[model samples]
Target: MTAEQRPPVRGYAKPVVVPERLDSLTGPTTGIVVLPRHLKWSGNSRYDLDQPGRIADLYRTVLNEAATSDDLSRYLDRATLLDLWSSMWLPVALRGKWEDRFPELRHRRYDPAA
Candidate 1:
């Protein structure tokens, strides 16, 4: 799917508090739009949720980093990590037509055992 076609990332549950006096003219605004912590894209200056590829890339990074880190095991067990790896493509899969563009994403099949 094209980046434009992707949906905006969900916002944080708590709105960011903008300081009342950034400048004399600017007033305090509640919930100023900001990127969701979970959805932040690596190497992206701006937040664009429409790109499923970004999510895929982020998952790839997470998997790679987790594999090399000893601390990851303390937070997540093997089963949980495996499940996360298996389902990493869910976002791109749900969008449809992404396989042609991103071959890295494997097609998830229904496995009775799973």
Candidate 2:
């Protein structure tokens, strides 16, 4: 498939930063995770993982704002990210970079119209 032209990805200084491996994402699957200052600069920082909507929101925010793969590793779980990828609201650039690096993400469908 051809790539779509869009704005450059932000939050990281380097271009297209993806993890060397996904299994390293061994973060909490439940409970509240209060985001760090660098990750959550504004709004509410605490995310209740038990709540589906809140967790999805948290994943979306973290995925978009993370400065590096380590930031993602610190907050996101591999299973949770795989389960939530299709539903989370994400920027085109952020989503594209991830989907490119991880083909499994491409299989999960996201409908912005929803």
Candidate 3:
């Protein structure tokens, strides 16, 4: 197949930032919360939320205040993150089998001591 005839590969684009939506001053002084844009996926393409780009975006938007591992754990559960990783990054054929083998991926019990 010619280069042009081959299917085009999808790539990650920078997340759309809404300055107005972001809190100008974030910290103890300001109690404002900044919510991230919802993760959107292109139909059935290799592109999905599990990519580093998307993960970075998620951290930027949802977990911006997660300074420490403990803080991060409180903000978002590890299982949720793993689920996204499995669902979005894993090949379709492997998802069910992989999830079955690794049931722990379904939900991670939070342990602050750890």
Residue 79 C-alpha lDDT in model 2: 92
Q: What tens-digit string does per-residue lDDT give for candidate 2 at 1-114?
A: 324554555665535456877897878878989999878999999999888688888887777778888988989889988998887777766678788778888888776776
Candidate 1, residue 56: how far the Cα is off, in Å: 10
> Model-by-model lDDT, in order?
0.34, 0.79, 0.35
Candidate 1, residue 110: the lDDT equals 36
Which ranges of candidate 3 are over 4 A from the true structure?
A: 1-60, 63-65, 86-114
Clashes of 3: 0
Q: Which stretches of candidate 1 lie over 4 Å from their true place?
A: 1-61, 90-114
- lDDT order of candidates, top first: 2, 3, 1
The residue ranges of model 2 lying beyond 4 angstroms of the native Cα positions read 2-16, 110-114
lDDT of 3 by residue, 1-114 (tens): 332443543442332221221223132211222332232232221223444554434433343223333434433434444534433443222333323444554344344576
RMSD per candidate (Å) reads 18.4, 3.6, 15.8
- Model number with the top lDDT: 2
TM-score for each predicted model, relative to the true structure: 0.22, 0.80, 0.23
